[model samples]
Target chain A: MHVIESGNVAAANGVKLARAHVVAAYPITPQTPLTEKLSEFVDAGEMDAEYIPVESEHSALSVCIAASSAGSRPFTATSANGLLYMSEQLHWAAGARLPIVMCVVNRGIGAPWTVWNDQQDAFSQRDAGWVQLFACDHQQIIDTVIQAYAIAETVSIPVMVCYDGYILSHTYMPFEIPDSDTVDGFLPAFSPEYALNPAKPCNLNTVTLPDIRPDVRGDTAPGYMEIRHNLHTDMREALNVIKTVDEKFYSIFGRGGHCFIEPYNCEDAEYIAVCIGSLSYQLRDVVDALRQDRIKIGVCGLRVYRPFPDEAIRETFKSAKGIIVLEKALSYGYEGALYADIKAALYDCDNRPFIHNYILGLGGREIKTQQLLDALRQSCTIDIPVPQWIGLKM
Target chain B: MREDIIQIRWHGRGGQGAITAAKIVASAAFSSGFAGVVMTPTFGTERRGAPVLTSLKISKHKINDLSPITEPDMVVVFDHLLLKEVDVTNGLKEGGIIMINSPRPAADYSYKGMNVFTSDINSVASSVGLPPGIINTGVIGLFAKATGLLDLEPLLQAINIEFEGRNPEKNIEAARLAYENTMIGESR
Candidate 1:
């Protein structure tokens, strides 16, 4: 069904359709509406989910961890400082291999308390084992939520569907919401391999020991090598499962494109710009206009961030003369996180295009289409600059 | 044939339904067989009474321009205060139209090189027993009178579609008052 709704409402509907059993979230700017809408759905009997209004972001994730361990499809959402507050639990969730799905309304962390669009929150958690997917538009926002459930449950890893804070969260758009039955047919019911059951009484979250060292802490425990290997393998296997679930999703929804990466007008383009979140929409128009003028320009939107699609990245930029990386987050000392990843992925490929990193739209600064076009033009002309900031006043 | 689309930029505060008004206008235009897109560059920290700019592009052809309009063929100011805070007149094409929801007459405001139409949309709304914030619908009616780009019948039909099954009568009455009270002509 087509509904004119806000991104938050769309996400809430997606979570409901995905049949999440438990949703625990603390109210934060931008992220509040999502939980609030879910609460309404719960109260109206529209969704059969337990709406847990937690005390804080930390407690929110803690409750989600507990719920997921109890064999329920658990979901939660937070942003900026909220994500920071739940940082410890994030590691716990990932290490425990809990199939928790979260909607992160990306916002800037604050000393000044800015509640605007930025990737600082999600990007800061890049090392966490959760599979991260950034959505470019409202439709993607809804679709990714459903896809996240399948991907996370398939690999027993948490997944985050990240979108710009105010850009997509608060903005209203026309979105297609699949009926509940249709969603159920697409995304099966959650059935975990292992869960916390008192009857079985299995050990969970035990201490680990160092390799080749005895009595390191006090007692011998699980090997650290084994734990690390397990986590790595779970994450690695998640990449292929994400692709498989996305293929199934495409078949059900009848929308065909790479769910992990959306390539726009890139088949024969000379210059390509890579971006995620709302900026991709702006880049799409710029590429279209440039293509009309016979300027071989294209765009690639990286939807999947965690377990980054390295092979796809290399192939996407293989033919381009130059690639511009548009990021909404900064790493301070080094280049943008995505830029570093792309550079590392293409290090072995011959004739690799100069990858210019453009940091933009931080603290919710507006990024116009002209600015994106200007950045693309600059990338085509000069050597890809290091740590270039776009739309910055100084 | 090139579609003669009328792009409008709406300036209002949050909770004022500025975005909803744009959607209703677009939906109305769509119901009239014209293609349109409604969008807003929302902020994560948007609050009540905060300045928000929403836009609507109505044309017979597909609109692929996602960029915010630097210059608009029509400007609709839902709040009087936004006029001072935002440059609603910037990039306003020649012979463009400006619709302001103010009780004061059009002659009171001085804006050269553009046609300004003024209406007491709030009073009209209150008279119809609707809230003051429904001035966006009034502004849309003024848009219809100023440009004739949309017919009132389709506009009302679109409004019914939006408010239908929920407050349909009041919305239709609000649209009618707005269509009647709008003062349309060239700016002084």
Candidate 2:
């Protein structure tokens, strides 16, 4: 159905269409509406799911872990502090290889206490063993959530679909929603290889000793090291699953999107801007305006951040004269997380561009167009400064 | 108005439906075949009677800018009292349009440097039996009639969808009353 809605509502629709059996969440500012709508769906008998209104974010994911382990499709959502609170369980969920899907409405972390948009909360958890997909708009939010379930269930991994808080969450846009039947045809029911059952009792997360032990089949069981190694290997394999699911979704829905990075008008451009999440929309405007003046500027939006689309980044920036990476989250005492990844991607490239990283719009600060324009113009010079802080009060 | 993009900023109190008005207008524009339509209500803590802001950008082509509308082609004030508390004309384009929900004549509320249009949205809402504090569609009708940015039919359609179950007829009636009763004026 074609309807005008907010990103939060679209996310709820995605969860409903997926027919998830368990939704466990603790309401945060921007994440509140998504869960509220889900609760409404459950109450209205539109979806047959148990909406667990947990008291804390930790319990939210904990409940999801229990539900997912019991051979049920589970979903949850949180942002900023709530995400941080659930960090311990995040590792547990990933380690257990649960195909749990979460929506992390990206918001500024509290120290100064802000409830607005930023990517730091999710970026800070880049090593949490969950696949992270940042959405550009409401439509992408809905589409990515559906794709996330497919990718997660197939790869035995968790997926977090993120979009900037309030910016995409509160803002209204027209999104084409897929019917439940279409979605069901695209995403099948979750059937796990290993689920906790009383009939065939199995110990999960058993303590591992220094040496490998023999299994009942006379084969050596995976140790703690091997388990970690397998997790890494599965993550690497997940990159392929992500792309294949996106292709299948496009074939069915006719709206194809880049699984990793989306490059806009970068084929014949000298200067390119790199950003993530909803901020990419603003950079596209700057690119278009500069293009009108024949500045040959382009933008590349990082869609998937966890697997870190290294090859795509290298390919997109191979011929560029300069690259400006604008990120909302920083690595404290270093540069932006995205900049670090980009630098690593092009470290061995033959034609590496003069890269500059600018951390902007932290803690919900406004990133104006004029500031970005000036930064881009300054980046064109020969002697460019790295890690230029845009719109700093100091 | 710029043919490529039309930016509008709305000034109103927290409970006056300024945000809803902006959304309805954008929905109307989108329903009228404008593929690029965005409506953003200012984020953060909001309380009733407190001043708030929202913005809308409508384009025939794709709109890439996610930034707030710093410079607006049209400025809409949901409550006349907001003009006293906030600079309702801030960043308004030269010869741009400023609309207010005032009962006075358009000429009476005209500012020094922009065209002004006035409509008694409150009266229209009251007459149509809409409860107090819901004048979004009424002012939207006045906007559609004054600027012709969106067609009246689409505006009504949007209103119908916005207030689908809660007496949509009253809201549509309020909108029609505002559309016919609105007074438009030239630049002062």
Candidate 3:
């Protein structure tokens, strides 16, 4: 059924369709509405899920971890500081290789404090071993959440379905809600190979020694090295899983075959602008304007941010004359995190495009279309230079 | 006449339901005929009565521009007091419109080159027996009548959805009352 609602509401509906076993989250701006909708669904008996109202983001994810470990398909969401508070648990969730799905409503992290939109929150957590997928619109917000669950369970890695906080979360738009029966057909029940067997009583994630260790049965158990190695191996394998799940979703629902990257007019473009989350959608209008101005430019919104989709990125931009890497998160003394990754991704290309990076929209700064136009126009005309800041007062 | 995307900027205090009003219009426009409607509340400080703004963009096709609407087709002022504090029509397009909520008639307020419409929404709120704090719904009626951008039935329907349990009839009545009272003023 199609309805006009907030992106948060769309995400909540996605969770409802996914049939999350446990819903735990703390209230935060932009993300608050999403949490409230889940609680409403639970309270009204619409969704048969354990609605755990946690005290903090840490407890929220902790509840999800416990639920996921207990063989439940658990879910949680937060933004900025809340996500930061769950930093340790993030590693625990990923390192343990639990199939937990989280919605990281992207927001600016606080030093001075902001409740607005940015990709910094999720971008800063890039190395946490979670499969991060970004959404550009309300449709993608719901679709990605459902797809996240499928991807997470397939490979047993936590998934963060990231969308810009206020930009997508609070805005109201039209999106079709996939029917429950078809959704069930698309995603099977949570049948994990490993779970906390309460009756058998074995501690999961016990302290592993540096080298190979043995259990009470005198069998060689995977030590710390093998554990990390397995996780690393599975994460790389998840790229294909991401593709298969997206195909399954499309087969059932008839939309969203764009799994790794969503490309717009990039098939034969000279300059391709790249970014994550909703900024990439906003850049589309700018690309349209540039097309009118007789410039062959397109936009590539990198949906899967980790396991880093390097091969896909390389193939998409190899034939382009220039590549503009526009991002919201800066590595603080270096360039944009995505800029560095895309730059590294191009090294394997036989004829690499001249890549440029523009760091913009940190802490909810406005990135107007005109600014995007000028930036891409410069990247198309001017030589590659150091990372520049868009809309900088100085 | 610009017929592609009708972008409207809403100006009101933080707690006065400016964003809520924008969302209602977006909902109404979507159900009425338009294929795309997006309501974005400018995210920032939300202390009550502090100036807050939001924008509603409705298009015949999908809207890809998520940037704040700098060049709006119309500006809806939920509080006339905001007019004195800020230039409510800063980047309004040529031949754009303005709708204001005040006790004064439509002629009392005017902006250069823009058709101004004003209605006594506070009085409409009282006469319609709306809550003391519920003036935003009344302003929607004025917005609908002045702009003719949306139909009355869907506007009231959207209000019914927004105020579903909290006396939706009162809001519907307020919208109807203000819609009857609104009129376009001469633009100089």
Candidate 4:
């Protein structure tokens, strides 16, 4: 049914429709409403799930970890500081190969302190071995969460569906909630290959040697390095799984083309703007504005940030004249994290453009479309400064 | 800035339900055949009586931008005092309408040459057994009558859906009364 509600409610409904068996979360700004709505659903007997209200974000993911180990579809969510608290478990969940789904409402990590939106929180955990998905709007937020469970379960890797905090989280927009029965048909039951059972009494992820080692049964098993290698290989394979799941979801729901890199007017354009989350949609207006001024520009929103869609990135920029990447988070002293990653992805491409980076909207700073237009206009001229901080004040 | 979209800015204190009003208006616009309607409320922490604003965009086309609306085509004021506390008039179009809630007639007020329509929305709320400051729903009538942008039936349906079983009759009646009572102003 078509409904007008906040993005948080859309996410909560997606979790409900996916029939998540367990939900564990700690209340954090922006993300708090999502968890609160889940609790309401469980309290109102709408969704049959064990809502475990944990004390901290760390414990929240820990609960999901423990629950998923027993072969339950567990879900959780967090924001900046809360996400930072879950840093250790992020790797643990990914390394353990658990089919856990999480929503990281993107926000800036605290130095002095901020409770607003940014990509820093999620990007900081990019190397944690989990698949990351970014949503541009409320509809994508709901659809991606449903698809996330499918992707995570299929590949046995955790997934983080990231979107801008406050921007999408609080805004009310039109979204269609898919029928529960259809969603059930689309997403299968959660059945892990290996699960911890009390009756069986088996140990998982025990200490491993440097190389191939023998277990108590005298059978050879992959060692620590080998296990790490398998995780990396599965992640690479996950790119295919992501594509399959996207296709499957579209066939079932009729509302998804946002694959690894969802391109907007990029097929025919020369200069393309690349970013993640809602910024991509925001830049679309800029693309239209630029087009009127006779600038051939477009946008490529990186839907899957991790497993880094290197092939798609390279293909999109194969013939483009320049790439203007505007990001919310910076890699501290270096440059924009995604900008650097995009450059790294395009390094091997023989035909490439002068890619430039603009850092904007850190700590909830207001970003105007005019500012973006000016940036894109200058970047079309192809400036030399790598990471120009927009809206800087002494 | 787009010619096709109608941008609306709402001014009210934190507790006056400006956010919910914007949402209901967006829903009403959608029901009134607007293909794309987006509402963005003030994003951070809000305290009671502290000024807050929310903006809604109604368009026949898709709204892909999430940028702030610096200049609005219309402004809805839940409390007249908010005009003093906030710059509600800044960047408002000269020919735009300012649907405001006040006891005085619309002719008594002039807001930077923009059309002003006044309503005693607080009294409308009180007459309907709603608390005095709960004038958000009552001002919707001022919106409908002053702008003539939306049909009253869709708005009433939106209110019914939004306030289902929570005194829907009273809210509907309050909206009807305000619509009948709204006075259009000649810009000063």
DockQ for all models: 0.34, 0.58, 0.58, 0.75
Stretches off by above 4 angstroms in model 3 are B1-3
Per-residue accuracy of model 2 over B114-155 as CA lDDT, tens digit each:
989999999999999999878988998889887888789888
lDDT of 2 by residue, A1-394 (tens): 7777889999999999999999999999889999999999999999999998899999999999999999899999999999999999999999989999999999999898999888899998999999999999999999999999999999889999999998899988889999888999999998888788999987888788766799767999988888888999999899889889999999999986688888888889998999998888778777877878789988888899987778878888999998899999999988888898898999989988889999998877888888988888788765666788999998
Return whichever of 1 and 2 wins on lDDT.
Answer: 2
Binned by DockQ into CAPRI classes (incorrect, acceptable, medium, high), candidate 1 is acceptable
- For each candidate in turn, the TM-score is 0.91, 0.97, 0.97, 0.98
Tens digits of per-residue lDDT for model 3 on A1-394? 8788889999999999999989999999879999999999999999999999999999999999999999999999999999999999999999989999999999999988888888889988999999999999999989999999999999999999999988899888888998898888888888999788868888778888999978888999989999999999999999999999988888888888888889998987999999988888888888988898899999999999998898888888889988899988889898998989899989888898888999899888898888888998989998866698899998
lDDT of 4 by residue, A1-56 (tens): 98999889999999999999999999998799999999999999999999998899
Candidate 1 segments whose C-alpha is farther than 4 A from its true place: A211-222, B1-6, B13-15, B29-36, B41-52, B57-68, B79-87, B103-110, B131-134, B161-166
Estimate the Cα RMSD of every predicted model relative to the unseen true structure.
3.5, 1.5, 1.7, 1.2
Preferred candidate (DockQ higher): 3 or 4:
4
Model 2 CA deviation exceeding 4 Å by range = A216-218, B1-3
Cα deviation in Å at residue A346, candidate 2?
1.2
Q: Best candidate per DockQ, number?
A: 4
Comparing candidate 1 with candidate 4, which one achieves the higher TM-score?
Answer: 4
Ranking by TM-score: 4, 2, 3, 1
Two-way lDDT contest, 1 vs 3, winner: 3
- Model 4 per-residue lDDT tens digits across residues B1-188: 46788899998898888888788889999877798899988766789989888989889987887666778999998888777788888889878889889998988886767899998998888998986677778988888998899998899889999999888888888888899999888877
lDDT of candidate 3?
0.90
